[model samples]
Target: MECLTVKQVADIKGCSQQYIRKIIGQGKITAIEAEEPINHRIQYLIPVETLPEDLRQKYYASIATDGPPVPKEKAVKKEKAKAKKPFEAYTKKEREEIMQWCEILEIWQKKRNHFESKVEGDRNVVGYLKCEYPDKQISVDILYRKYAAYKAGDFGGLLDGRGGWNRGKSAVPEVLFLQFLYFYLDDRQPAVSVCYRATVDAAKELYPEMVAQFPSEQSFRRKLKKEVPEAVVRYMRLGEKECFDKAAPYIERWYDDTEANDVWIADNHTWDVMVMRDDGSEVVHRMYLTAFLDAKSGVLTGWNVTDNPCSDSTIFALRHGILRHGIPKVCYFDNGTEFLTYDIAGRGHRTRKSQRDVPKPETILAKLGIEMKNAIVRNAKAKPIERTFSTLKEHISKLMTGYCGGKPSERPESLKRQLKNGSIPVDSEFREIIDTLIEGQYNQEPYGGTEKAYQGMTRLEVWNESIQNTIQRIASEDDLNLMLMRTTRYQKVKRNGVCIEIAGEKLWYSNADTWQHVGDEVYVRYDPTDLKTVRVYDVEDRFLYTCQVEPALLLNFIEDDKAALADANEIVRSRKKAIRNYAKGITDRLPAEYKIDMLDLSIRKAKLAREGVNIAQSSVIEPIRIDPVKETDHLQELPMASGADNVVSIDIERMNARAEMRKRNKRR
Candidate 1:
């Protein structure tokens, strides 16, 4: 291969030297950088032998042609890499939201006339934006940025990270903030400002240098509201009740395969109505309504309207439910004193080591093999009875004549205006009203949460569907008597009969078969509401007799006069005994120095004649006595002190000593 200078190539090819130099510059022909003495400067030359065959042919052919192909268009230069945008760092959801904003902006831009036509009143695009997202308050400026980003790179460009430097990050001392949060989460949950101030103060004490880094109260609040999760905030501010009811993770808890009588929830409700006493007199009294509902069926198994709620009242409600639907597998109760009583929980007293006489409810439920369960305190959602009560009050109770609203603020407008004027039905009338509502309305109405299987079915209907398969535990007559009866322990029998005094009234139980056992001990049981007769059980736990109200003194003869006469005679007997004891005490404490005259016929006659007093004479012998010493005008007088300074202090040391007698009189 032989090398050739650029000038020779140009001469052979019949082209200018500059044209050949241009081809070499374009690298179409082989070229090497070298120094040329002719121009005394650095230059490049081509070798004819090393030239590409195509280019060599083109050079020879161009000599034959008019001119070499015009230099191809200058090679296009590569574009510098596109600059990365700030929005590229945004999260996926953030990008999505931005894209949605971009869509709205695009719509606003494309249909400007249509959007303007839809705008009403004095508002513009903002009103349209509000219409689009009724919940969110989007602004035009926010949409402008979104549109710019969208135009730049579509969805990816819509993402933005501006003004988010402080996001998900806090400057406030975390330990101090948590301490303050815990303080607010307590039962006394304080205000937000209070918690903030507490945190600031604590930060000052614990880490003074970091106090300056703490954000403003408003900024801190925004951070908490935006960055902190709702459940975390609720747990800190509202305590467990709110956490469990509102913020806790939801769990679907259905009975699954449970039947109607599988579980029963019981609770006591204070009714909104004001019922009067049975005496036809209006009174300011509220009635308590204790009720039981089948958990599975939502049926009103039993309910009772009473003046007060106690263990007995709770048992009454339970008994009513049991009689109607049989015994349940479990009785779910609230943390009320009535429901938490020993009777239902079957808790034995620490002082009473023996379970000789357990509460009737506990005993009966145990015998029936039923269990009791209590819901967490203050957690109303755990028990469905709360919802039932709410439904009842809203739908039924509010329509009643004397419906006192649940709260003072919820009182009816009519009731508020005429506070003093309201219809308070008598006890019997109120009872009837309650019975009608429970039986006819509550039970017969469809439950709000009825399953698809039982849709449109009344609670009673659902209950009836499963009632046949239920395990029925019915109480016998004797069992009912024993369970419902209130017991009085340590009662003794008296000669008149097995005398038992109740509320200061003596009651007697006498049977031809057991009258001879008058001096025995007995346990009495009866109904507090109806005290006409009391059942007596002997020491051997055998049924002895039924005691009737016996008035100690027969001052009146009438049926149903048990309490009135018995109470009167008790007062008479109490007064006589008190008088006798008082007289005996005075006689025994009489002064030994004085020769007392118990009776004097001359003095008595003179006093009677002088006073002109009459006495009722009795066919009884009277004893007369004379004074051992005659009355004298002179008598020794003891000095009296007017003040504490002049008073003398008596000392027991100066008293005479008595002997310890060996012989003693035994008195029964």
Candidate 2:
């Protein structure tokens, strides 16, 4: 074999030098392998008879298009090199550590969003991890830089570095809520006194190496929408989650709410909780609370919870509450169909028969003669039963306060010797604390009105007053009869000179005494179920006449386009100086100054003054004066301060009933 240089070949083949070079590099045609002086790499030469054949003929074809090919000997060496085993990878423990650090970084990132902590707070995390893994195979610097990138933009190994797949997803994001029970704040959970964000902070002295072991708060939250389970962190939720701590029983004898028989209000309230089962693991459950309340006593009957919707928990709670409390004459409830509608109209007056897929009335409970008092749809004020839930929450909060201390931490501690033995401390332990606090400090705490009111009455006294007054005003026999009657529209007719009509075919006749004048349209009180029946008098001992039925539309109180009553309120009170002045005469002189104030106007008025020095002695006047410091003694003579309707009644009427009561008790 013989070969020419690229320049020599171009000269012999009548092509450019670059063309010969292209043929070699393109690998479209081959040259023969031959030994060279230095064979360290490779040597080749072309065969003189080996010109390309027809398919490979024209120079216009893809002669130099393909990339260069390796020589067979060289290609074999490349294959053997590729076949060599790859380097060994990180061990399982190392992998686990990496996964943990990523998780910790993720959690730290989440904490940033929920807090105003310094950037240093976030930076310190990286600093810790770097210090912990100083001698690791993977550089700590790389992890820090990558995490910094994640902070700005979540691309790259964002998920990989955070505890995305590696972090356990057994609990929801609520597990991320860092709750610590402070024994100083609450003897039990129902009473809490502070609020902290559910996240880690500089306050948490976690080691630098641990960041990678936790999930970013964001990852935990995102996983919550998908329901990733995690351990729950328990805390006293009083001050942070709800009103448990501040609520003191104002009414000494609030109706006990835990009883099953009375008012059952079922609604949803969030818990700042970490639910712990018999196992050591924890979870956060969004509790659906259904507790029974004694309408008369304001006592908590009982309560229950459920993890999800369409649960049996609410119904079960109602059953338990009912059994605990006596079967209420009128059991109050909300409109959730699951509990009341399990059976038709059994326990309540109103049934859950709305067209919107609502459940029917509890026919089973109603059969037992238990009537339901459902709150007005969307109106929380319509039911007193629903209003008493704070009583239970407050009770629980007071209990929690006893067991916690400042810089608070809640661990299972032996309840004070007064409570019970620690090993068997269950509900019994919690209950003992509740009772002790209620008796000692809680009942002694004074509370009167809202931020205003009487200011110092104990919650027990206030609670007692509210219930007693409400019961007297709205739950008396007078209220029942009036509430039972229904409204009916009727027209005047001739029935032996009486108005007659039928509602549900029930019969009633309104003679001249009740019907007075025909052709006067009036609303009447009648039973809708039995129309002919007229309900004359009501529970409040008042006649249900047409005037009361249509008071707003029929009884017009307008005067000069404003309410007559409002206009009357602007008049001077009968006992004021203005009234006395007006009664005697506007021109009469006042003792304070020898000046006459003219009130009523005259078209042509003139002032009479004696210009001459010889005025009559009878015209001379003297000013009357009294010391204001002696006002207390004179007040009984002067009209009650001023404008008082009856000065004698001021002491009995003006003093706040509660204040007066307090004064009387103190005097005793």
In terms of TM-score, the best-performing candidate is 1
TM-score of 2: 0.22
- Tell me the spans in candidate 1 whose CA falls farther than 4 Å from its real position: 1-218, 226-232, 248-254, 327-330, 333-382, 416-419, 449-452, 473-483, 487-515, 518-522, 527-529, 538-541, 553-668
lDDT of 2 by residue, 207-264 (tens): 2212223445455445533442221212222343234223422233344332223344
Give stretches of model 2 more than 4 Å off.
Answer: 1-268, 286-288, 305-311, 344-362, 385-387, 391-668
C-alpha RMSD values across all candidates: 29.2, 33.0
Query: Each model's TM-score, in the order given?
Result: 0.51, 0.22
What lDDT score is found at residue 379 in candidate 1? 69
lDDT of 1 by residue, 501-567 (tens): 5547756654333444557877776665567777777766678777666444445566477777777
lDDT of each: 0.68, 0.42
